[model samples]
Target: MLPGPADTPPGPRLEAAVAAVAAPDVVFALSRDGQRTVRCGGTAPPPPVPRERLRYELGSASKAFTGLLLAELTRSGRLSGGEPAAALLDPRRRTDREPITLAHLITHTSGLPGLPRDFFRRALPAWHTNPYARYADERVVDAFLAYRQRRRPGTHWHYSNFGVAVLGHALAAATGVSWEELLTRHVLLPLHLDGVAPHPGPAGTDATGHRRDGTTPTPALDAGGFQAAGAVRGTPEDLLAFVEAHVRPSPTPLAAALHAVRRPVLRRGLGHRHVHTMGWFQHPTAYGPLYFHCGATLGQQAFLGFCPGTGTALVAACTRRFRARDTFVATAYGLLAEP
Candidate 1:
């Protein structure tokens, strides 16, 4: 079994950091020096939320997993990274303009729009109970078939949930297995992460995602439609373990692929640089570079990030959406700072 923080105590500096961010029910784990680790916080005491029960909606963090899967397939020669995405769709569905390749999808450089307009206006309300709960594979295919190229495929980067969704379809078509199955076989199982489950909550082990406000619970997203886009949920420790595995140097093909995924790709927004390797945002900090991502769905706000340089990972999740006065990246760094 992987020894956690209990095996190695944290220093005073780290403990103070945890106390500072203790308000929002934050759960954090760090493995500086790659082996010695420390963890703090919980929804409650005496095992506040068991790693199994503390399910957090990872938001776009799922994109990193998707990118890793794609990279692994490409490295193993099962799929071609350079193949145009149009090849995966029916010819009748092909959009005009430059071709989109798997690389473009991984890098968010395909120039596709953030999401189809219909998704927000039409599909969103009905599925609003679960946002993406009702989106089916058939609708995904139809959307791809009907989509028009909004910009050239490789010239510029644009973050598009729709593009990643299409890539998920392409992977499914290539592997002859559903994306959920692929993730289970390749990621969850290998990482010994039993807590990670596909969207809509796996049978017998998952928590409902609630809005920040006290409104009704949002319906879980259908993993089939979101696929590798934004569907998995798990506890912060499970997420930390996953990060630890990536931080370690290994010769396995998957390990190498994960390393590749952390490569910086483009600039996302203020103080945030995008990583196409695994769809994470890289934020440079005083300690080192922090690889992080945040998600917001109605009333929920979630953030997960770690610095490979420092072996520090911070995860924060809230039932209600909370806007930050300063960038979360800065806030996190400030918390982890040596006092």
Candidate 2:
């Protein structure tokens, strides 16, 4: 019953933006003045739907949802960011690894590797396919337990997919719910994001992902236990709604939780001022600090960012995945830099 691209007419400004990026099947959404404008470019597949309705793998952008869930749990007094995450998991799962706090996981300072030690071993066979396809929850936990600390916990700002995935699992253990259910109940439902899915394939039309060639079907990341790391699938509209909440939070049930997530907690340098909040990276810009995150699957690239000074939030998604995928992120930063 949702409207497709034909029903939602796009303007020339959006057309120009997509063309400027040269991204195939690009969806762009901007929020300003309590209003939202969404549009898309490039070719779509059968049973055409509006680009706003086209869903793509969110990749690590899913980490923000996990971070929000942590904030919500904190707001409700269910958990504290300072607690040792190892204590929350089953004793058998705990190891001699240096203790990491929930805060470390949220800020990517847990000193865990970006991927599990065993990740490459398992992923190599399916390197071109879905690398995270069959990783089980138990295995994910075991990998965390076996991982040696690369540095003392909280001493470095290393981005670790393994750390976030462990955080998701620890929260699940604390809440007795799956990460997907926790996300839905704590974040998605409260935000009214009906278009977001727990995994790549779901009901309704999903935008077909592409390779650098712009034609090959990119494999969807059917991550299991690693789902927390990067498995969410959603449309640009849904992502815009999420960023809007960050830009201009209302007195919604999650206002306090949202505020908690955006609080600047860790600075990256002695005087550089680059910062990291719960799930967003704060970059110094002419328009003040821009809080943003970018995600990538095998074939899709997504960028979501918001500028507090301008009250503007933007989302850019490309159906094709390539080395230049970061170009979309650069494009988003440029858009924020606009006066």
Candidate 3:
């Protein structure tokens, strides 16, 4: 079992950082040198266990998990990402552009758009609340089919929820199972991350969200077709545990895969200075390459990252996604990248 967040107290820097976020409730789970602690702040009181277990929507940080699943499947020889993802589609129609491989999907180089076409048709109605939840799985597939590739696959990097969601479907089509089951079997269960649930159940959670006011409640996004993109949700503990596994992966079920994710896979941004690993964005610092990915639901924000060089893992979660969410990201990144 991982060490509990109560084992140690956070440093002054972490405490002040957590307190700065404009949230009614927030938690910062920090692990360093194998010790961990959770700093709670904001107007709301610290949530108890179980309620605290799923209180934050992980948003795009979920891509890290998807990256892990892709690595594990590739490691186990389940589905070689080299195969064209189109083969897994319903009609399996060939496109005029270069064939998009499964690898391209996970790497965000599939030449797919950021969103599926006609997404706004349904999303506009629920723009402020759970937009992706309106795009059902079948409709998502149809959207993929309707889109014509504007850029050549593998030529450039463009983050696309459409690509990853399609990859989830392709994996399911290949394995004859759902992405949820695949994630549970190969990633979550093996890692003991039972709290990172994408769907709701009888056991209600304290994971509700709030708008910018930090008081008005906002509906949680239980993504329908976009589950693979960003539906993962859990407490700061759950996220810290996940990142901790990467920090010291030996003996873990996905140790090799975990190590593989940190290696720079693609380079992007100005002068190719930014690094893209299988799961996280890589930024080199005096400490080392800091790997991280952040996400936000309509009302909540989350940042997850770790630096192997400095041996740090940080998970920042909050109920309100204020306009200054980037400030939260900068603060979290500072915590991880601090030498």
Candidate 4:
């Protein structure tokens, strides 16, 4: 699987650790200070693209970008984070309790369910391949309007794809553009993530996603109703470029928003384990504050993390989805946690 011109990743543990994963291959990207490295590990056949340039589904990791967009829009005064999300929704349901705000949507404090209304009816039919392919835009808006919040907005931290998806929709509704267009205009272009998109791109440029067994290939997922929550496919090179901006001073337009996303926004859940920024999860490591997020499709997985104090950013991706065990997230976090 070591088939690219990319530099070998540093650390005594990284090479052996990433290479040992059982999937078709894992591309591990790392950057510390200003140095960068990308490495590929596995026995399966390599793709035509360079390891650093090969695209993998970012899944939920796309939320960090959504969070950045939220910050950038707020900073630009183009959109108000404190404004009610219902204002942008199609149905604009009247809630008697505290209304859900755009801030609540990005922070996952909007008391919405993880999946949309009647999701099981669609998901049950294609659970193994692509569950989200049928949950279209109209269904998503209907779900939001149908929601009844027993708990007030911002009272709890629930990771809701539905909530973030609505955030994407609301931003677009306010700006008179599509969610993909908003993300491209604000985040992707500013970071120079040239080929990254919310939907699938050209087929040959992407690594085929496979199930854990490494034999069954799964269909590429559409963000469909969850565009802001997931639905991005990108290369390790671009991903490292994206995470680096969080730890390194950037000349990009998103600099302030990048800094804004680093602040801890909320902590809720059992034992107070769920600490978060607008998009990324914040964990207090012995080294410093580490912000990270992981994403998964039916057949692929991705992870992104950065430690501001250590000046470290990392991305790890696998071509196959695991049923139970996941080595990428914890392993990448450990490498970044080490000085």
Scored by TM-score, the top model is 4
Worst 10 residues of 3 by lDDT: 1-10
RMSD of each: 5.1, 4.9, 4.0, 3.7
> Which candidate number has the best lDDT?
4
Query: Per-residue lDDT for 199-277 in model 3, tens only?
Result: 6544457467888778888886768898888888876777788999998888699998998888887988789997898
Clashes by residue pair, model 1 = 129-219, 130-219, 212-299, 212-319, 212-320, 261-277
Which of 3 and 4 is the better model by TM-score?
A: 4
Comparing 1 and 4 on lDDT, the stronger one: 4
Compose the digit string of candidate 1's lDDT tens values, residues 1-339.
111343345545445444544233344455555553444542334233443356767766788778777867776788878777667666455444468887888788887777755676656566555566556777776776667776777778777888888888878876788888888888788778876766645453443444443334555545557667887677766776776666663744368677776776566555554433456777566666667666655444456666766655555554434455523334454443321
Residue 145's C-alpha lDDT in candidate 4? 76
Best of the two (2, 3) by lDDT: 3
lDDT of each: 0.62, 0.77, 0.80, 0.82
Q: Which ranges of candidate 4 are over 4 A from the true structure?
A: 1-12, 91-97, 269-273
Whole-model lDDT, model 3: 0.80
| TM-scores for candidates 1 onward, in order | 0.79, 0.90, 0.92, 0.93
Q: Counting only residues 3 or more apart in sequence or on different chains, how many pairs clash (N, Cα, C under 3 Å) in candidate 1?
A: 6
